[model samples]
Structures are given as C-alpha cells and as structure tokens.
Target chain A: MTMKKRNLLLSIIAVIVLFGVANFVQLEMDAYIRRIVNLCMIYAIIGLSMNITNGFVGQFALGQAGFMAVGAYVVGIFTVPVAMRPGVFYATPMNPAIINIYMPLGVALIVGGLLAALIAFVIGTPVLRLRGDYLAIATLGFSEIIRIVITNASSITNGALGIKNIPPLNDVRIIFLATLITFILITLLINSSYGRAFKAIREDEIAAEAMGIDLFYHKNLAFMISAFFAGIGGGLYGALLGTVDPKNFLFTLTYNFLLIIVLGGMGSITGSMLGAVIVTAGLEYLRVFDEPLELFGMAIPLFRPGFRMVMFSVLLMFCVLFWRKGIMGTEEFTWDKFVNFCKHPLAYFTKKGAHAE
Target chain B: MEFFQAFANMTAASFAQHMANGISLGSLYAMIAIGYTMVYGILLMINFAHGDIVMMACYFAFFGITVFHIPWFMTFIGTIIATALLGVVIERAAYRPLRDAPKNSVLISAIGASFLLENLANYLFSGRPMRFPDIPLLSQNIAVGGGVQIQAICFVIPVITIISLVVLLHIVNHTKTGMAMRAVSKDYEIARVMGINIDNVISITFAIGSAMAAIGAIMWGIRYPGITPMLGVMPGLKCFVAAVVGGIGNIKGAVLGGFILGLGEILIVAFFPQLSGYRDAFAFIVLILILYYKPTGLLGETTTEKV
Candidate 1:
C-alpha cells in the first residue's frame, strides 16, 4: 500500500481498538474512574478548541471561559427535565419562553455550540481588530461581561444561584465519539486552505495580507469555530457535572486551557489531547501533595491544603522558563516518527541533544 | 421617577462624602495604576505579577505588625522595601531570562509568575481571609463637616498620592536615571547603543512600580482591611484598565484613567443604585468603549505599524 493508504488503515484499526478499550473501561470501571475518563475527553475537546484560536490562529484571545459559559448555560437550561425546571429556577421563575423548553442532550449540545458561535461572531467583529495584549485583555473583558450578565439575568440563568439538577452524562461512549469527531474535523480544517490562511496570518499579518489573505475574516472564522467547539465542550462539562454556574466560568478557568496548550505544545492537535489527559489525571494524582502525609509516624508539614496548587503553578513557571516549546512544539504525532522513536529511543535523545548543542 | 427620587435624596453632605470617597479611591487606583503604567512604559509587557506583589505587600505588612510586633510606620516602610526587593527578584528570575523570547512566551511566563505568586501566597497563607492589622491612626473616622463621617485615610491617601506622583514625575523628567528610563522606553536597541544599562533600568522600573504597589496596598488594606490571597485579582485587572484608559505608557494618563474608573464606579452606583449589581462590569465596559473609540488611549500617542 501507499504510505497514505497504510496510515489510513492503521488509524482505523487503532481507533477501533481504542473504542473497544473505552467501552470496557466505561462498563466495568467504577464511577470515579469513569468520571475521570469522561472529563479527559471533555477537556480534550476544550483544549483542542483553544488550540484552534491561540495555537493555530495565533490570536491570544482569553474568552474561552465566556464562550463556554454561554454553551454551559444553554445546555443547562435546555437539557434539564421539564419537571426539574421549576425546582432549579425556584429563586425566580424560569423565563416563560424557555421554561418548558427541553431538548435531548445531543440537540442541546449542538444548539449550545451554535449559540456560542453566534455570540462569538458578534463579539469577534470589534474584538478581533485588536492586536496582541490588547486582544487578550479585550476578550478577557468580554468574558467578565458575559459572567456579569449571567449573574444579573436571574430569569434566564437563575442568577448567581446557578442551575442544578442537569441530567448527568456518565456514558463514555457518546463523549468519546464527540471528542473523536471534533479531533477529526479540526484536523481536516487545519489541513485545508482556510487553515493555511490562519497559519499564514499567525506567521505574519502584513505578509499574509500582502499574500491576499483576509485577516479579519480568517481570524473571526477561527474564533467562531473555536467558540463552537468550546460551547460543545462546555455542554459536555455541564452534562458531566450536572451543574452550571457563572462562578464556574471565571476567567481563571481560561488559564487551565492555557496550561494544557502550553504543556501539550501550542498548535499541536494530538498534543492537546495528550495534555488534557495528563493535566486532568495529573491534577487528581497531585492531590497527594495536598493531603497530610506521614513517614514512620512522622508528620510532613510541607504537604498542606494548597500545596498542590503551589506545585502546579511552579510547574507552569518552570515549563515557561526552561521548556518554552512544551512537549510537542508544533509537531504532530506521526506513526513513522513514533515507530522510529520506539526502535531507538537513545538515538532520538542523542540527536536532539546534539542539535541543541 | 425612582432615579429622580434617588437623586433628590442626595444631601450636600452625602454628596461631599461621595466625592471624598471617589477621590480617595481614585487616588488609590492611581497609585496602583502607576505601577502598571510605569512597567508597561519600560517593558512593553504587562507585568501580570504586579497585583500579586500588592497582595504580598499586604501580607508582609500583616506579618510585620502581628508576628514581628513592629511599629506600624516601620512596618509600612519595611513592607515597601521588601516588596520592592521582591519585584526586582521576580524580574530577574521570571522575566529577565525571557528577554529575547517570543512575545507569547514572555506573556505566558508573566502569567506563570503571577499564578506562582498567588498560589504561593495561598500555600503560605492558607487561602483564608486575614484581618489586616489596624492602623488606628489611618482608619479612624473623622467628622469633618455637615455630619459626613469620613475615614482619616481618605484625607491622607490623595495627599500622599499627589506627593508620590510629583516625586515620581520629578524623578522621571529631571533625574539622570529618569533620562535613562525614558531612553530605554523609547527604543531598547538605541538605549543600549547609547550606553544605557537595559537590565538595570528594567529592574529599577519593576522596583519603583512595586514600591508604588506596596504604598497602594497599605492604603488599600487600611481602607478595606480585608486581606486574602486573591485580593489583588480584581484591583489588578481594574488598574490595568485604568492604565490603558489614560494611555498606557503615560503616567498622567494612568492617573486620569484611575480617577475616571474610581469616580465612575462610585457615581454610577450612587445615581443608579439599581445598577449596583453590575458594578464590576463598569470598568470593562469603559475599557471596551475606550478601546473602540480611541485605541491608543485618552492621552496616548498613536504609533504607525511598520511593514
């Protein structure tokens, strides 16, 4: 077979095996492990969505949390059973228009994504015109504005109390499928002409404009698509957590994705997915550092309630300081490279070290 | 009718009190904003850790007064010095190494530094809200006139803010170090070519900015008296907004922007109490509007992008 055909065949077989394993884990594993798996997929989707804008487009927009809020609220509003709406919005009645409105999880997810995209389209017009730090701050401002609006609009969002009793989405199969589809679609886009334009814009705005690429259109397109996926991811998150609140979508939440992208290597698709798994799992694993520990009946005072976060922050700083390129550094995981590395791991390190030297 | 009714109910004393509150708060904002403006002027990068430096300063003051049993005035001075040193160390450790790195990398590093500072505070301070040591001299309520009770710090803050601003301006415009700073801000390469020490200027900038933050934090702690690990986040963001509003690289602009934000925040709530719930959104709305109308800021000079 040609290299392309062989790669395609391998991909299909790998995907099938992955699904089989996921199915086994979902069915047999306890709820705790299963929740982690679901979260990994949801976070993967969110990370990939962020990578589209921050990585691929090279726009440092800090509005993912805002867009995710829009999506989460939509899903929370629509996916809750009609019977539970009164209880959820007991503080103030749900807006009569959307009060009895209920949609299946799948439809609600799409609707949420579309609504977020529409909002992104509106917001991107003015916001995307900004450059660098200005854009980042503007997007961040918009995110806060979104949160504030959610807090005040009690009839719609149930105000600061937040919507609860969201139908729990524990099934790993659907979430996994959604994540797979998102990855494939984003990968395809990144390979297309539009994606090339985005890359060109990221590389140099003036040069790209000189090359006849429309900067505004392309940037906004990437932003809208990013918002769409972030919305879907947000919907999935609400489904998984069975809760949605304005506090949950604070701008600080954006930093989580920022960490993922930076650690995974910005602009790398598979890297983001890998990062999501590592960050989600690693954060949980790092809980050991938060708990008081004993060795031979001696208390270790260093392990405390907030030490885990302190360690996490230090890791981020260390990564930025020494390993700025992160794990993948704009390179994708190709089967050929993987096989080569497997065969001669020492050679890979030696070559890399030599190159650095 | 309600708006009219609210406006009608405002007495001269209440109005004066609000004005005093606005100016005091505005000056406090101006003090913190100067740090952001000065750093942005020198480095062309937002020192995201500046706010955390303020938080750290408050903690330093807290520890100095409570644990060390230091006198309040000495504690304030020590806190400023320590915070200034912390600023210099942060710059040397986190930012200096990334001098030639990509802008994104630098920004990420700055954010990392910020998160590190905040989380470290959380770790050390246990994320609990601590009572800021009361400086009774500052926090005491004084009846000035017409039954309007105002804290003594309100009178002291604006006076101190003006004094510092004048001192800062004098240093920037008249002193040799100030000339060096101006040159560095103008063009790093040209400044280096002119035999100015870039690293030293940057370090000095961070120190001054942080010292200002310490001053602001002291006053802020006295005024509000609630200290927490995340205390700086909102004020940090708002001061950044102020720095931008007045024209980021201009000191006076930051001061003006600070006043605008402070007064706007107070007056909006005073006149439209119903809109008080949307208070935090006020700064962002002003920011977006300013960015849309005058992208360079109110007093900022526009620069053409070179091909």
Candidate 2:
C-alpha cells in the first residue's frame, strides 16, 4: 500500500530470487566461476574494512596489506597444520609452543579480525594524531614495516616460503552465505546511530568534535573495526587458498583496496559491495587485455598489451576529472530512495543505479 | 706511496667511503626531493602520483632506447618534456577540479592516479624487473686519489642537481608566475579574488615539479641500473619524507632535507649492519622524530592556524 512497504517487499523478493539463483549457480557452476565468486567476496570484506577508515572516519591509510599480513599470518598459523606452517616461516621455529593452537574455522576468522584490530589500536594511537596526508604516509609506513618484520621474522612468517596446506575452502555455498551475512550486518550497522556519528565525523571533524565526539577514540574505533573486518577477510582468504605467503600482502594489496573505495564512492556502504563485485569481475574481464585485442579487424596492441591497466587508469582519471563525487557520493539507500530508484530503473542504471536507490 | 700512506693515515678509508656514498646518495635524493618540495610549496597537496610519474619516465626511457630506437642524447629532453606535459595533464584532470573540495579528496585522487599509473605501467611494461642499458657516459670510472675511484656517472648527478636547483630557484623567485604561486599558497581565496588564474598557476607548478622528477627519474634509471613498476614507490616515498624533513614548502629546505636523509640513510646502514634490513625504517624514524621535534622542518617557520 505504501511506498516503503512496497519497496521492502520488492527488496525481499529480489534478495530471495538472487539467493535462489546463486544457490542454483553454486550447484552447477564451474570451478573457475566459483573461484571468482570467492575472490569477489574476499575483496568485498577488504573494501568494507578500508571504507571504515577512509570513507567513514576520513583517514588516509595505505598500509592495509600490512594489517592483512597480520591477519594472514595469524590465521594461517592457526588454520594450517603444525608441520606445514613450519615449512613456510621456518626461521620462526614452532616452539612446540603454538603447535596445538589449531582453531575452528569461524573462531580462526574472528581471531584474525581481533588481532588485526588490536594492531590497529596500537598503530592508530600516535599516528592518527596528525591529520590529512601525514596519516596516509604513517599508515603506509606501518604496512611496510609489518611486511619487513614478517620477512625478517622468518621464524614466525617463514619469510618468503609462507604458510601452506591451509585447508581448501572449495564450497562456494559457504562463501556466498558468509558474504551475504557480513554484507547484511554491515549494511544494518551503517544505518544505525553509530554510523551517523561516523558520517558526521567524515563530513566535518571540527564540527563533529565541537558536537562532543571524541575524535581520537572514534577514529581508533573506526580503524580497529575496519582492521577487524580486513583480518577476517584475510583469514577467509587463507582458508580458501589453503596456503598463504607474505608476498601476497604487498603494498599493491592496499592500492587495489584504495581504488575500490574511490571508484565506488567514498562513505557509501552499498557502493563498496557493488565496487567489490565489479572490480573482482573486472580483473577477470581484463584477460581480454592480455590477448591481442581485435578492434574492427585491426589487432590493436593498445587494447591488448598492458592495456587493461591503461584503461583502468583512464577510467580512474575520468572519474577524478569528470565524476569527482564517484559513483555513489555520500548518499545512502533509503525507503524513499528505493522507490524513486525502482520507478526509473533505466535512468538509475545510467547513473550507477541512483547511489543505493 | 708516502702521500697515499699519509692520506690513509689521516682519514679512515671506510669513513671517507661512507661520506662519499652518503653525499652521492644524498645528492641523488636531493634531486628527487626538489620535485616533492616544489609541488607541496604551491599546492599544499602531496603529489602521490609523482613517484609513478618518475617511474613512468623511466619506462618511457626504457621504451625509447629498447623499443622506439631513440638516441641516448635525446632521452633527457624527450622524457622530461613528455613527463612534464603529463604532470600538467594530471594536475588539470585529477587535481584541478577538486580545488575547493576537502583536502582529502585530492589526496585520494592522487593515490588513485598512482594506482592507475602503476597498473598502466605494469600492463604495458612487463611489470617485472628490467636491466637498464649501460650508457658509456654514466659507467666510466675516474680515480681521483690513491684507490678512491669516482664513477663518471656520480659527478654528472650533483652537477645536474645543482643546475636543476638553479633553474627552479630562478622560476620560483623571478617569474611573475612564481609570485602568483606564492600568493596562492599564502591564501587561495585572496589569490582567486586578486584575479590570478588559479588553475594555470597550479598546472605550471605541477609541470615544473614533474619536469624535475623526469630528470630525477632518468638519473635514477642510470644510477640504479634496474627498473620496475615499483621502483618509483620507494624513492617517491623517501623523497617525500625528505621534503617534509626539509620544511615542505621551503625549496632550500628540500635540498637540505634530501642531503640529510640521503646521508643519514647510508650512514645508518654503514655503521649498523643489523639495521640494513630496516633501511626503509630509518626514513620513518627520522620523519617521526622531525615531526615530534620540529613539525615545520629545518627551514620552515611554524605557523599558528586561524581556526
């Protein structure tokens, strides 16, 4: 009868249909397709974590991979069998100390999240004291240090050999379910009062501080929460691959995450989900870039050789130059927004689906 | 033989070696540092894409020599001019639009441009490490005294650095454009209201900064003898730290900071063998210390903001 009710009903129906179709695809899809889906979910978790710091709390953090390294190593240590882990970070001899700390999958993920969050708390304490680009540089420094520590602390991280036999997470169904749950929970939390406070801080820190929001504490909270999610993502990644290496968490890891946040629109939760999916798929779609691209019967190497990243940069430049607000801006999905979006899906499609409408 | 002995007795060979390496490396860093300082002085924005721009210049050189058949003599003007143009274009496209936006947006955009450029390089180039061609001009060694041999390449570096500084100094102090730049940096609104063309000034600043980076990039390729998509990340970051150390907005401070950091980095490595693994850490430690002790840097005067 009402627009809100109608929109809610449509959303429910749409989600149910999506889930039903996803389940069907999971049952029938090829291994490659399933792997792509898993990667998308993993990246989405990372994007969500990054969004907390960059999008919500407005801090420039470029060292996410460093935190992910903490998550990956911690989770790998717990998830991998004792004998295999020693093979990776062999310098850090298994003291017979942590040999028996194998955790159940869920607990391992949470442990990974909690450990990363704790690390963030320590890092953010002094670093976030500075504002703007200085914070980015500090966080980036933290990530690099984490990487070096892992490399040098071979006894702990096995240096470059990394952790292996982490147990294969072949079930796409589990990933889909986990991703859905995390997405829903985050979406709900972002709609809550706490999320509003986060947004207020993002909009104007001075204004937010004037309103009595403790800047340091809230920033720390946002950072830890982001790291928590990132850690979980890393844990899940370790489980999925059944092996982990320090190199996997290079500075590049954070760059891609930055791209996801910027392209999706800073401070938009739904945009994060959409960005993760699109970017994940886009990485695959770019395989065409590796092939000598056939353009109107002319094999254009421009589209073929390293052209994917060129196009990606072109897209990035286009976004910055033209669409500075990104695809979503700071706008969020609402009941009225949903109705308005659904009313003209074509126009919505033309402009990034109306930023969560 | 007596003189050699006397020279050795007077100065520890190791000490001389460390000092030489420090000064050489510091001078190299000083060159890169100028790019970072110049941009920050005008825009109050750290050009994160700068390192990638330097890296891009190296790739361009690599392509010119290896792929496109360009002569080595022409590479200097070729790469610098091209990169300088790219710097201008980047500022126009990525940075100029967000002139009035919150500082964070431009910061993020610069990072995005960094990723975009790196990935672009990775895609086009092999993204793997490539061996730099040996230029006869750079590889020659001249023994100055005793067994102390100076690479012909080393002298060219400092000479080039001095020349670059002179050019930049002239531009910043003498040009009408430089005056407009100083005006903009002091107060953006006042500059805008004073009928200065804000975008043009910013673009020129970016172009000058980029041209300097191009020279630094070419020198890095020649001296370092290896190239990768990631080559710029470390130097870009280190030079940026150097810029901050020198008092970001001060040109003279950048050169001073670069030399200090460059020398400091090498000396730390030389004295403490264990710290070699943490060579990168030294910069951050210095940055943090500098930030704590004198947030404004060596040549910078501290300012109380009008909140």
Best by the DockQ measure: 1
Q: Work out the iRMS of candidate 1.
A: 1.1
Cα lDDT of model 1 overall? Answer: 0.92
Q: Each candidate: what lDDT?
A: 0.92, 0.80
Evaluate candidate 2 and give its CAPRI docking class based on DockQ: acceptable
RMSD to truth, every model: 1.5, 4.6
DockQ of 1: 0.76
B138-203: candidate 1 lDDT, tens digit per residue? 989999788889999999999999999999999999999999999998899999999999999999
Across B1-307, the per-residue lDDT of candidate 2 in tens digits comes to 5445544555465566677678777877887788788788778888999988999988888788887878986977899999999999888778888877788778877877888888877876767899776788786777766577767777787788889899888888899988998898888889999999988888888888888888888878887879998888888888888999999988889889989998999877776666688898788778777877788998987887554
User: Considering only chain A, what is the TM-score of each predicted structure?
Assistant: 0.97, 0.88
Per-residue accuracy of model 1 over A1-357 as CA lDDT, tens digit each: 787887788899989998997899888999989999998899999999999999988999889999999989989999889998888889899889888888999999999999999999999988898888778878888898899999999999999999999989989998999999999999999999998998898899999999999999999999999999999999999889999989999888888888899999989999999989998898888999999999999999999899988888888888888988889989999888877898999999999999998
Clashing pairs in 1: none
If scored against the real structure, what TM-score would every candidate get? Answer: 0.98, 0.89
What would the per-residue lDDT of candidate 2 be over residues A1-357, giving only the tens digit for each residue? 987688779778977887786777688999888888888888888888898888887787776898888877777778776656556545667646677677878788888889989999988887777778888887888888888887776655667778777778877777777777777777776778777788888888889989988888888888888888888888888788878887888787787777677778888887887778887889778878778767688877566567776776676666656676777877765667776777987876778656766
Q: What does the TM-score come to for chain B in model 1?
A: 0.98
Show model 2 residue runs off by greater than 4 Å: A1-22, A86-96, A294-298, A339-357, B1-11, B62-74, B144-148
